[model samples]
Target: MAATALLLSLAGCQCSPSESDTASKGTNAFQRVTGDDVESDRSQWDQVYAQDAYVYGKEPAEVLVENIDILPVGRALDIAMGEGRNAVFLAKKGFVVDGVDLSEVAIRKAKRLAKEAKVEIATINADLNTYQIKPETYEVILNIQYLQRSLIPQIKRGLKRGGVVVFENQTVDQLKLPNSQGIRRDYLLNVGELKELFKDFKILHYSEKNDGKQAVARLVAMKP
Candidate 1:
């Protein structure tokens, strides 16, 4: 199989069936936005992360696990870092890590997990849609599962020269799966779209594949 067609298991794709139901029911509130419109999204995620168990499990994404050695260790940022599995992993590997998430509950859980692992990671609770990443700041950045096209420029600007970005998210083919309901098409990457997004960067790894459960796009690229 070609590199982009290889099937590989990745973590943090979605919550379990029970967990999904819980998030829809809105069982918890974390950061309360005063406006009725602003709080819905955050509240839903807060509910998901509020559970006793981690919604996406504690293991870091398989892509990060496989490609860590090639990435330069320095200031690392995890975007939309729900519960901080990746952040903690990078910290253990000796990176100064910062994790940002909209859910305060998730941030709290991430801190707790870091404490349990005897590592320290700075956690920021902010909406990625409005969050501003400092220009040319991070040596490594991880954008796993979460997709925000509007944030792409910020991601590019946030990296210093030669900085690498590791990203993985569901592809449009994911709708072919049996359990793909409620997953919005707008959120899915189109075929070859992932590569096209980082066309200017030097791509180290790129793949689009179906692994029985879901179809996903994975990419590792370095700034010029």
Candidate 2:
């Protein structure tokens, strides 16, 4: 039964911290995060937020803003939410948003910023590898500037019918650029890889763009 399957998926979700989950700012303060390990990544991101009121700035990503009209304005999830810029933006647009990240410190900052924005959003501090995404529960899911290939299936299952997913992250081509420092090879998507992953879905838009020093892939797809 579909209900049974959904229940099983939810049961498989993980939320505990791993042994590598210790707190320390990484050697390179500006080092890139590849979703390699939750603890070290969390520590680095926490430090980033502690120093900047909004590390990526207060605006929603351009991809999200440009495609905002097509997104269903209901339950939404923001993966690896960082300082909650996108999550807060969605909340303001009347979406009930839930944000998840490995950094408790980042979540704290997100909650504070949400309050400042006069919008409410639920937040969870959990490692992405262990975090269980509730199945078919959200009308929209936003994954920006983070990539975890293993999470693709979960992302598909986490969306409600007619729901959309907006994802953007660096591509393997980024490795060729000198400015693309600290980005791990495995974290970058190969050309056509992002679209191929969601082949069965209705892809509204997809592209690979050279943004300064990094080559990035962006996609907007909907569940059938």
Candidate 3:
């Protein structure tokens, strides 16, 4: 009942259910975007990507680059893959990468960046909340600076048996900083919540650190 009410309230903020619904097909059929918050969220991202320059910069995340060698370089998925920086990097390393984000502007920029870098990456303009992750389909999965907790189960199932997952995002400690990004509390992971969430998997690396710029929880794990 509480979940239902929360969904309703969020939907009221984003868009109508009828407006947000995507086609029900294959794995996408079961998981659907229930409200307007998702759409409103996408609009904000689209605005960000529409800027003259890449907001987060063109480089792939440090966490991703540092752990790239450990990952199995086959089919990869980058969720909330803003501008495809990480996806493009994986493609350069010979991984067939698919990057998904809600903003078409971001996808266009990602494609442009991939072209300039002479690497190939498939980009999907779709909201991750309703995006269907095929089971056992990807050898590596990457999530950076994005938090969609409900997608955690799907991420686990989408990996091949020996596949790896690299995730890095702001931790709850960010809220303590004076000039923090003001991220929603719900989106921030607790001190040990990241490793705990993937406890079933073999955790290779886990850390919580604040470099005086940002506070984050990073995790690298592999499915057995």
Candidate 4:
């Protein structure tokens, strides 16, 4: 009952059921927009890409770069892949990489990064809130710095048996700013939420800790 009420209150803002069910289909994902304006978020991110001169400055997240060797070889999916740093990194490591993001400019920049890095990557511009993950499609998945709470099931479902998912994101406590980037509290995880979501999978590692800038967690889980 509490969950239902919370979902209702957070509708159109968070990763609730409806968003999870239909995120991929929308050209204009108002629900996924950080705040009231999809055009604004799109323009804002486009400017960020432009300001950086069409290069997202592609470098893998520190955590992902450090643990690259641990990823099992196979098809991989990277969510909210800004600049395709993680995706290109995976490709360099010999994995077939597909990266998805919301910003077309980001996708283009990611492709440019991949080309510059001398690697191949597939980049998709889509709203993840409504994107559908094909069941049992990938062997390894990388989701870093992007949180789609309702994606827990899609991630699990999209992984082949023995598939691995390395997911890292901010926790509710990471909201140190006076106002968050419009990400709702209900959408952010509390400690232990990731572990609990993948409890059925084999957990290679799971940690919830602070890294000075944020309260965050990383989970490496394998589908049974």
Candidate 5:
């Protein structure tokens, strides 16, 4: 079932050129993708990758690093793990890792980075909404820079008992600040939304803030 979900998720990928347009005449390039049309096919990621290099530069996410001690030496999962940065990092730290995303191109790059990092990580190209996340399976799960509200419950269920989830992503308020045109409210999270959505679990940490153009909410929650 998970395999089927992975295959079907990439069936309609499309990346609109306008989706990559400039926010102003003389500003930095920002593609704040909006809309609930996450039904994108593989070609959409291909378009984005064609314009950039593999791995999108490899480095562990800081949030994951800071909370590394909480992660048991067991299987870990990475949701929307573009370029494999976090997965490879976990592998290096002695964890069996599985990375999932909707972008084949991104998965390829992630593989390349994993090889470059001399670490092994299983990469699954699948959309989160349809993917069958096995319950209580992983000791650590990472969700960064991606938002799909429906996946919250499954995420809690997918963790091993006492497992931890580190989530970091932009919020709706991010665009309210100055120079916020590169952000999309649809693609961003809302304040307290994370806590409310995953209220059944135990929240270890939570923060909502806008740092420059990045409006983000981060939480380290545990499944009882």
Candidate 6:
């Protein structure tokens, strides 16, 4: 949920690798920011999640629900899993789920939501900028509405061979929307940038579209 101020309610279209080939490439190089930056980010999210209700609601992201059939049922890691919507959904679907977020409040709420949903999930409160993702650890990784360019490589390495990664986040075009104010530009993806970031993986589904409320980029890819 990095810099995602608005709720996610977008749909994406399917695209091929050739469709994304012309897009500018993205880097996986580590770009560490100041400690203050990390602290500030966590504080803001903590405030948002401290509310009594879920900021993004309890249902799983539509992208994950739509593509569940293609994902393998096994250990799954939900990155920036804020409030455990997707993580809980995965657990209920028979996956052993682990959710990680920067805010302790979010983690607490996630655990609560998991209990309410009658599913078990592990929660870790950590800053992704510095947290280590164990290599080849998960059968599936879910990244929804969060972007940390530097974490891309770690995500790739964290997946077991043949494992899948489901990712969805705001695109630059989201800025054009009236409710897009306050969303950080750096957290937004370029039209084909999401696909470019995971170019090495077998692209299963990729899309960039404006679903009226927000423009988003969604991808489902499998490690070879």
lDDT of 6 by residue, 1-224 (tens): 34323232222212133322211122111111122466776776676566676656677888899999999889999998888889999999999998998889999999999999999999988878788999999999998877888889999999999999999988889778764545567768888999999999999999888867668799999999
| Predicted candidate 5 versus true structure: per-residue lDDT over 74-99, tens digit per residue | 89999988778789989999999999
Give RMSD to native, each candidate: 7.2, 9.5, 10.5, 9.7, 6.9, 9.8
- TM-scores for all candidates: the values are 0.85, 0.83, 0.83, 0.77, 0.80, 0.84
lDDT of each model, Cα atoms only?
Answer: 0.78, 0.75, 0.74, 0.68, 0.69, 0.77
| Tens-digit per-residue lDDT, 55-80, candidate 3 | 45667888888898899989999998
Task: Give me the overall lDDT of model 2.
Answer: 0.75
Candidate 1 residues 2-107, lDDT tens each? 1111111222334566654544453221111222333666676676567776766677888999999999989999998888889999999999999998779989
Residues 1-55 of candidate 4 have per-residue lDDT tens digits of: 0121011111122233443334323222222235344455556555544434423
lDDT of 2 by residue, 44-161 (tens): 6666557443555566877899999999999999998877889999999999999998778888889988999999999998777778899999999998877777789999999999
Q: What pairs collide in candidate 3?
A: 11-36, 14-36, 14-37, 15-36
By TM-score, how accurate is candidate 4? 0.77
Cα displacement (Å) at residue 59, model 2: 0.5
Measured on C-alpha atoms, candidate 6 has an lDDT of 0.77
Off by over 4 Å in 4: 1-33, 37-40, 53-57, 176-183
In TM-score terms, candidate 2 sits at 0.83
Q: What global local distance difference test value does model 1 have?
A: 0.78
Q: For this target, which candidate reaches the highest lDDT against the unseen true structure?
A: 1
